[model samples]
Target: MNADNNLYQLYQSIELENVILSYKGEFTSELLTALIHILEAKMEELGTDFRVRKRVFNVIIECFQNLYHHIDFYDFRNEKLEVRKPALIIVKYKDGDFIVNTGNYVMTKDVPKLEKRLSFINTLNKNELRELYLEQLNKGKISSQGNAGLGLIEIARKTKEKLIYNFVKKDSKISFFSLKVVVGN
Candidate 1:
């Protein structure tokens, strides 16, 4: 299809998916805050119940923070990209469930470690997840990026869904890491 037609097709898909918010760019603290505000307003506009909105809001924050912090981990290495490619993020409400997804580039070598982590988290039940969260919290380990390594656990605990993730190799050196979390009744 032509470029315009391609764009139109993607737009139609997004609308049909009931996407509430979408952004694909470098995320900064200010931008994250702004996005949260926009989504909160959108939820209010849709008359989302207070409790549901709160849960969805918490998951969105964790997702955005994970995206933002992980990006900088490779900032020193990925500077050679064509023009500092931006990451992709989308939030949609479908079939009464809120889905948040984010994708960013990662070094191919690091994919295994991340994939393993998520795989383990997906195997846990709600109680197991709660236990793991507490264990990590008590350990008090912090990465150089100031992350306590609890974002995924927290997201799982809040959403109570198996995080859907994929790593598509973009080139010899880099891959695109995509993650999806769904929360609903």
Candidate 2:
């Protein structure tokens, strides 16, 4: 009875938020693909505008790829495998806009660099962002994980909004990074 009540409450909460879809767990490639398909179907069923749907889909892809590549799998000391690399993603509708919120675990040491990058990106105008994106793309800069490091920039470009983020310390070694992007309809 308690479990059922809790589930009902959760469902009501989701309804209140107008959430279209949500996932919380390991972010694997297979799961990413499945999520993309599901979201596409939902968007279609909702009759979302093509441009809005494209922008939202692009940002979601970038967010998921950021989680896939940058998530820390081991402890800060690089000693043992962390039990779970949990991630959360929620797509919701509010005021004729689609909001995407994604959360993942990151190593504490990387937080500063991530903060700096996001801060810099936030300072740019649309034209400046486009120039930077093209410049980076032309350079073909690739990270150790084979990502070109353009996910953040592309996300910002697609959403045309400043990325809202929070880093909550989970422990001494890890922090949970949450990012929110909004796309206007």
Candidate 3:
């Protein structure tokens, strides 16, 4: 009964929030591609401007990459729960702006570095972000997973919006990291 009511409240909230898409499950390349297509159709239906649609797609791809690459399942501390730590992606359109929110579990120890990096990114203007993105590209340090560590930077540059995040401790070792990015003026 409680769960039903909770879900009902959630449904009501989603309605009020103007959410266009919401997914909370394990992420994969195929699923990500499907999500992009779904949003592409939505943009088409709404007659979104070409430039704004491009920005929206760029930001969503980056967010999906972060979810795909940065999940820290090792910190889950339970073999039973290690199958797949589900992540979340929520897209909302409100007042001519599209808001994206992605959440995933991360190792608590990584919180400080992530917080610092995002804080620095938030402080930079569009010009500075471009410079930093180019500098990072020049460095060319790609991870084993093939990430060049430029997803956040690219998101910020494309959106020209501050990256908003919150780290909520889930346990002693694992925390939920939620990031929100806004695209369109």
Candidate 4:
């Protein structure tokens, strides 16, 4: 399709999906702080309940951190052009519920482990998720980077919904991992 047509198609898709906010670019701490303020203001303007707003904000933080910490930053020097940083965040509202979606690039080798972790989190009920979250928190299994590994569980517990995710192969060595969480008003 032509450039204009492609842009129009993207607009149509976002509208169809009820997207309130969408961003795709590099993730920096400064940018994330600004975005969080913007999101909070938007949610307030939209008359979102405090509880739901809080849940969405927390999930967004977790998703953003996941992108920042776990993303693979392999050099693509062989390519002539700079690849768009494979990071995206979208917030959509429908039927009194909000859905937060995030996408980031990950090493292909990590996909299976991630899929398994998400799958297990998805299978847990609220209490079970809470238990796991606390267990992990108490165990304090810190990574070299100081991550406690409770992000996914906390997202699931707060949203009270199964995490939805998909991994699409971007190349031989990397894949795009997308995750979605929904919060009801």
Candidate 5:
């Protein structure tokens, strides 16, 4: 993925890459509500099975909420919060499955650490992932951004699919982190 300062440019590139569903804008509470509606409609339009729709919705919620809690930014001009930092949700339709692609900006210094955690988690089976998630949650430890970090682990456990991730250098000190998750019917 090409990294640019402009989010619109990122959105365009993702679309050109064959993204089926996307929303590129501020990740406000309002926008999150709209996204739920859009996704619900899209599932209906696609005629996805009821059971599969629920799984899709749950995964999307967890992924977006992670971005909502992390992926920091600030707006100096207006003294406001600029939480709209290049977040995406791409759904790729295949013959018998769907893949969800998501991404946002993360600090370059933290990429290696995050990669290690993701790699370790990816090696675990569903039971191991669940155990790890519960262990972390019981510790009540917070992440660098004050999140529980359990969400990602829980996502992996719930989906039972290997989480695919890549970190691309966006600039001197920041990286663009992307993740792809697959679900089959």
Candidate 6:
């Protein structure tokens, strides 16, 4: 889902009512920084309160980092091969709510596990989410990708909203995961 230069420009140019910040290419440190800066500027222009902005930033950082650390990308050029993992994020800022969508490739076998995690997180109340997050953090153990699923739980708690997800088929072996969270002021 690579974006053309024109579309990217249009996205940057307009003061969108429902702004959708999408990342569909290589997820380098540089790209991630640029996205965060632009999003911050846009939120500032929208007159968002400091608390809301802080929460939004935290969610964005965690979401993007999770994708960056967990995804793998492969490249083949001139009979040489290189691999990299890329993450795609789409953040939509709508009236009274911010919708964050992020996606990354995952092994086919991991689908059920991810789904279960999402389901569990979505069902928790604020107190339960906080308890779960503290529990995970106090344990001080990290996952294979250096994550403890706290990001998802944090998004759920901060938003006080449901987390919606979709799995799109990318190929025989890999799948694209889309997660959307809405935080309302």
Tell me the tens digit of each residue's lDDT in model 3 across 1-185.
99999999999999999999999987877988899899999889888888989999999999998887765434345566645678999999987889999998887898999999999999999989989999999997998778898999999987746888899998887899999999985
Off by over 4 Å in 5: 1-18, 73-84, 142-146
Each prediction's total of clashing residue pairs, residues at least 3 apart in sequence or on different chains, is 0, 0, 0, 0, 0, 4
Instruction: Return model 4's CA RMSD, one decimal.
Output: 3.1
Better of 3 and 6 by TM-score: 3
Off by over 4 Å in 4: 72-84
Better of 1 and 4 by lDDT: 1
Q: How high is the CA lDDT of each candidate model?
A: 0.86, 0.87, 0.87, 0.83, 0.75, 0.74
On TM-score, the stronger of 4 and 5 is: 4
lDDT of 4 by residue, 60-123 (tens): 8888887776543343432543564558999999887989989887778888998999998888
In candidate 5, clashing pairs total 0
Full-model lDDT, candidate 4: 0.83
Candidate 5: tens digits of C-alpha lDDT, residues 1-185: 33555777867776666566777665665776787788788778889888777777777778888777664433332234344466777777666566778888876787889899889989999888878878888887786666776778867865637999999997775689999887766
What's the C-alpha lDDT at position 23 in model 1?
Answer: 94
TM-score for each candidate, following the candidate numbering: 0.90, 0.92, 0.89, 0.87, 0.77, 0.79
Cα error, residue 46 of model 1, in Å, equals 1.7
Q: Candidates sorted by TM-score, descending order?
A: 2, 1, 3, 4, 6, 5
* Model 6 misplaced stretches (Cα beyond 4 Å): 1-17, 72-85, 143-148
Off by over 4 Å in 2: 72-79
Top-TM-score candidate index: 2
